[model samples]
Target chain A: MPTPEAWAESFTEATNGDAEIGAHGKYYSCSYMLDMQERKLIVDMHRGRVENINLDVQPLDAYEFALRAPADTWRGMGEPVPKPMYHGIWAAAFRKNLSMEGDLLVLMQNLRCFTRQIEILRETGVPV
Target chain B: MPANGRFSPVTGRYVTIDLEDPDLGGEYKVFFLENGEGRPLVCQHTAGCHNHQWRGLLEDPDITRSHRVIAYDLPRHGKSDPPNDREWWKEEYRLTADFFTKFVVALCDALELEDPIFMGSSFGGNVALQLAWRYPDRFGAVIPVEAADYSPGFFLDWWQHPHANAAQVCASGTWDLMAPQSPDQERWKTWFYYTQGSEAFRGDLSFYSVDHDLRDKLEEIDGERCPVIMMTGTYDYLTTPEMTAATAARIKGAEFIEMQDIGHFPMSENYPVFKGYLEQALQRIEERIGATVSGQR
Candidate 1:
């Protein structure tokens, strides 16, 4: 299982200079926290680029938004061969496996960037 | 149990609307979700689908905060049951322009929404234009995604004359035109295309493929009262961007936009990719509303 720092590094590495991400991501600038029971990850996107990913922030009350899903759900999502609902944020949300709270519009507006970051962790075989 | 057990992310309830009466129907209830506050935005779904298509937008606090968003399932499509008066079971349930217009007007009246911006996709997209043409002042703006005045080449007679199974054909045909990048399971899953019963899909297609033609009438929709922004996806083969652009050219001030890497099913398939384009369109509508309010003052 990848530590929160390792997952953050993988996300930064994947989307640091992607052009399409920049285009669709232009409308977003927000802070989001992802909770995986034992571990928590926070991603800060400034003007459509990954500004930082802080791992030590456990409760994530400082961020504008937070998404909480069970560790099993995150593990399934991060698996190399993820099941259908486990692959994407919307899918998980639709299935009621994930609870998204706070600035929903910010999360949706920056959905692509956030989703890609999670996928990057999966691609890097990061343990939840 | 609702068809998909999918309730609206916002208020989960069914609102009553009189379909039979010219005035709002007090008899029948149409399933709808209304969320947030501000100027109302009435959203409609594509054929054979329900209002759940707008879930992502409904759930978004930013959009909901700025616009009172409402989306409803047409009669017989979702939780709203089929009409009792009509022998709908004996014949295919064709969606007529009259039925569509009345439903919309009645729903708006019931909700006490005045001049809400109307947004729709595919079959619902075509209805948006019809709504503007038929009742010019009823709407503030009409944003029709993947729509055209007349679909010259796309054929759906296969829906009725089944050399192959109609349900399978409709599902597969829809899958092809939907977001190519969406998961295959999502593309073929019965959830997306299987609602509204078996013949309902074919019945709706008759309106989409044959009855719904607004070629000359496009010019009749006033750009001021009902500002139109025609949008189509680059990947939508059924209603090509070229077709949507041609339709937009007929209106004096109508805007046209092509959503990149998107297909016919904007909400269901490849949502994150298509949402960016939807946001842009909504922003444009907001700008027009702002301008109109400013000018009137």
Candidate 2:
């Protein structure tokens, strides 16, 4: 497992460097959380670029939506070659205990870009 | 035929037909792509999608050589429009199983097809089951791909929610439905098709995730007569192989084929891989139909 600081750096760099997001995420501004059982992260984006990545998330931290799952689930998603059902949040949620909490409408609004951002986890890897 | 250009055997046409549903008799100008020359093989797309999902099957020279493949856009999908005579926008679009089944039958009837083989994926798959149950004597065989007896939890508001770009939400939302092993080009093409059908996607699911249920109706379907052959991809979490197998178990003579390394939209996402399983399915259907032949059926 990578350190939280290391994961944050890779995730931010990967997200910012993504071409698909850059092309299609003109309005993909939103705040979302990745609630891995062992750690939590709030990633804020503005026009497809990562505005900030809060590695040290507080209980008071806010996000429009959050993807919550066990560490194993996050680990599977973080893998470069995730097995079937762990390839995406929807896949994980349907077959595993991964849950999408909070305002899902906002999540759906930015679904296209957010989906790509999550895929970058494959390269960045999870902190847990 | 010309420099830097190639010609495809597949061609497109439009046909107008009256809906056969008892309560709805509206007319529809349906569009379809066709090729080949044998017993009719009618293809249906998944919910919110069009007949283009069968592009791979439509142009396959082997299948086209023996079977006349016809992939049609169920009204309001692709080139098919909504009820032409009614104020369609006045009412919310929620497809009923009765309407969907009748529509397919009417389309086939309009085309004057004889003993057609119906193959559909996702919601199209569910309707294949419905077609088998309701009109056993009509179709030669029904191949329901990535389907089960009951598939709920998909008919949601997110597809057409006002707060989101329905196109992106619908497209990206269903992104994971494909196996990661599929080529990015093919998967993106499927995604592009999805973007064009957000308006009809949720309504189509009305039949798929809501009205289509065959848990108790399976026995009523004489699979030996109509030859019901079901196939589900392993990566399809919505209708897993386990669910499909369980559904097949209850159907007296129906056969289930579990496709590996595929997902919900097999024909669209990964056609080459799906083609092998489809060939096996086609062979099984032929044997079953041959066994149950009564008179020229």
Candidate 3:
């Protein structure tokens, strides 16, 4: 079973030097959740930087939103070249394959950052 | 701290020149900006909009320190005055490759800029292609964003609507195709288009949608002396990635890059993503120049 914990290092590798993320201002800070299968990923972002990513932890809840989808859907979204509706989180939501709950503001605020984060999963090959 | 808070105010100046075509020939004031120092980097704005598109490049320390970024407002656009003979709105306004080519070379000569790197977006992109084809050895490199040989159906009802409100409607419709995520940028772009001289957008479209076509002329371009890079944003509905890719394929040594999650107006819509692509393209140009120098040695 693959956990979000196993995906953190790879996610960091894909995002750190990305031009878009680096240009965002210092006030851009947020946290969110990615729920697939039985695990929940709590990703912490500060000043447009990915600070921490924890998995399967519920002791302290600091997440602004949670994006839930079938594990198979996550796998489809994880494909190197995702098909039309499977390419991005917004697209997945639009197709009704993924449901977003809580703080829609934060999710939309950091949409590009989060979108690129998941796309990086394709590069990481973490087996979803 | 210029009028726009995001970037520095570029120094604006005007140069008067005579047009080649007698029917359209007259003294016209061409407005351009000169910012920073080093090798010249000439930027052309998209149709309708002014040189404000290059605000980011004008302020970027990395780009400005090594290159003098010069952006000009096309005739009947921004601060550039109209030709003495005709009114831009009342008469049929059209742009031809011949006139565009002459204007670019003249601008260079007037400013004493030699072999500057040419960078443009949309209609500006099409003009870049024309420049490359006309003067193969005149430019250092050609970087055209969202460039395509032809953009069919870009103006479906562009000038067909009621004259009074047509410009607003056209400008408003484009707002959706710009950066969907960024509101400030959208406002800026819409305002840029809205404030254009009536029918001026359509005038430039005459080139983008009608006159400009280099599909058969790509062979004439000397890619070795002037490296051509066609960059297309993924979200550009008018000039899609497929179109740019096809154009690049025809040119033997041209490079095509698809910018991710970006739209038609990259510099205005998604600066970071667009800048990333620009830097990468510039790096590639540097490598090619170095290799050429070494090869000749």
Q: Cα miss at B117, model 3 (Å)?
A: 0.7
Which stretches in model 1 have alpha-carbon errors above 4 Å? Answer: A1-128, B1-9, B21-27, B152-157, B160-165, B183-197, B291-297
Candidate 1: true interface contacts recovered = 0.00
In model 3, the runs with Cα more than 4 Å from the true position are A1-128, B1-9, B85-90, B186-193, B290-297
Off by over 4 Å in 2: B291-297
What docking class should model 2 receive? high
Q: Over the stretch A1-128, how does candidate 2's per-residue lDDT look in tens digits?
A: 88898888888888888999989889989999999988888989999899998988988999999999999999999898788889899989989999999999889988999998899988988999
RMSD of 3: 12.1
- What would the per-residue lDDT of candidate 1 be over residues B1-297, giving only the tens digit for each residue? 588687545886777655674322235657888787777888888877777777777887767766788888887777777765555566545667677777888888888877688888888889888888988788888888889987533334554444444554445445445544566555544344553344566666666777789987888887667788888976676677888999989986789988876677776666676667777877887787663232110
For every model in order, what is the iRMS? 15.0, 0.9, 11.2
DockQ of predictions, in order shown:
0.01, 0.82, 0.02
In the range A20-121, model 3's lDDT, one tens digit per residue, is: 567642545788887876566788888867788876567687789888988777877777765544555655664437888988656555554565566676
Candidate 2: residue pairs that collide: none
lDDT per residue as tens, model 3, B58-166: 8787777667889998887888877876654566667777887778877777787766788999988988888888886778888988888787555444343452345
Best by TM-score: 2
The global Cα lDDT (0 to 1) of model 2 is 0.89
TM-score of the second chain, cand. 2: 0.96
The residue-by-residue lDDT of candidate 1 on A14-128, one tens digit each, is 7776665666567557898888777787778887778988878744258888889988988877777565456556546644378888876555445445655566656766436
B249, model 2: CA deviation in Å?
0.9
